[model samples]
Target: MTSNEHELEDERALCRYCKAPVPENEWFGLEVTRPVKMPDGSTSEVDVDFLDAVFCSQEHAALWLAAPIPPTVVPQVTVFPRWTRKLQRMIERGRP
Candidate 1:
């Protein structure tokens, strides 16, 4: 087995979120908890449980928090084609 595979087997080397064993070449750190401002202006704490570090990669984390929630769109389905309207009339006349 490769060194990475061996490290994964070690169980102590895994990332808390993805569960992938951390590579030996990279530095690992714990996440820090920060306070978030709610819509009502009250502050709430959000813990980054994965890296245990203050934040994941700065750009990715910032974008994640700042992204707007998408608006909901409902779809309308068309039930009948023009030809099918004649079929509906046939059904109303009790034709099987």
Candidate 2:
């Protein structure tokens, strides 16, 4: 591949916690929720914007329940393929 030759966008998604790119079959998602006050004046859990966040495992999914909200992306860092965490992990693990 050449610098100008376009490649398919990387289809992989990373775990929200550990940031690992596990297989799709291994991907675990949990509902993003918030406490809602019902008409009866009792608090109840409701999905937040009907969104689901991904995790590599149940452990991470659980941890994410207490993790801080998503971090802001550094625009310059995201532009280069070399800086993506997924690529870095692949290099570290010696995977293609």
Candidate 3:
């Protein structure tokens, strides 16, 4: 493999939504946390880093959080049948 490819493979972050590989300088690190119960029956915050999730930009982060909008369906309308007699008359009169 090429040197750049090797370097990227060694150090790169994937976008949480699009799964695009992000470089170190461009990596948007977002600290994701979850509530956990402690031994004393108290709630505590725990950082989740299983995926090591990161985004390419803030826009991607927003998109990842927002729900996707569904596509709208349009009704199709067919044209009426042509008038054969009127068309024939118009052709005969050289008006067409």
Candidate 4:
């Protein structure tokens, strides 16, 4: 067989979205952009790209694009102690 075919035979990268082995020919880089809303009601942009793109199938691409954000489990914030709040108030008053 050809060298390209040999390389494809050796390839085993899988698509994160679909869990299928990716082929050599369809490998490509994809740029993803997400829009953000500012406090002033204006829109901003954020973007990221896959370090390496390898697609097992077109369905893999679709699923990755539609994945939901993972949840974060941060501890809840509590009110500051009375003494700390008083110290903060004194500090703020001292500032001109």
Q: Give one digit per residue, the lDDT tens place, for model 1 in 1-96.
A: 999976666954555434555555563454444454454656545522122422223444454345542322223466768858987999999997
Q: Give RMSD to native, each candidate.
A: 12.9, 20.4, 20.0, 8.6
**Model 3: lDDT to the true structure:** 0.63
* lDDT for each residue of candidate 4 in 1-96, tens digit (9 for 90 to 100): 999977777777777666576665775434544444454655545523224345676666666656763332223556679967887888999942
What TM-score would candidate 2 get against the native?
Answer: 0.43
Off by over 4 Å in 2: 1-9, 35-50, 68-96
Pairs of residues at least 3 apart in sequence or in different chains that clash in candidate 4: none
Q: Compose the digit string of candidate 3's lDDT tens values, residues 54-75.
A: 8888888777657442222223
Candidate 2: C-alpha lDDT: 0.65
Listed in order, each prediction's TM-score against the native is 0.26, 0.43, 0.44, 0.35
Q: Which pairs, if any, clash in model 2?
A: none
Worst 10 residues of 4 by lDDT: 44-53
Instruction: Give per-residue CA lDDT, model 2, range 36-75, as digits (tens).
Output: 4454656555423234678889899889878775633222
**Residue 88 lDDT (model 2):** 84
> Model 3, 29: alpha-carbon shift in Å?
1.7
- Cα error of candidate 3 at position 28, Å: 1.3
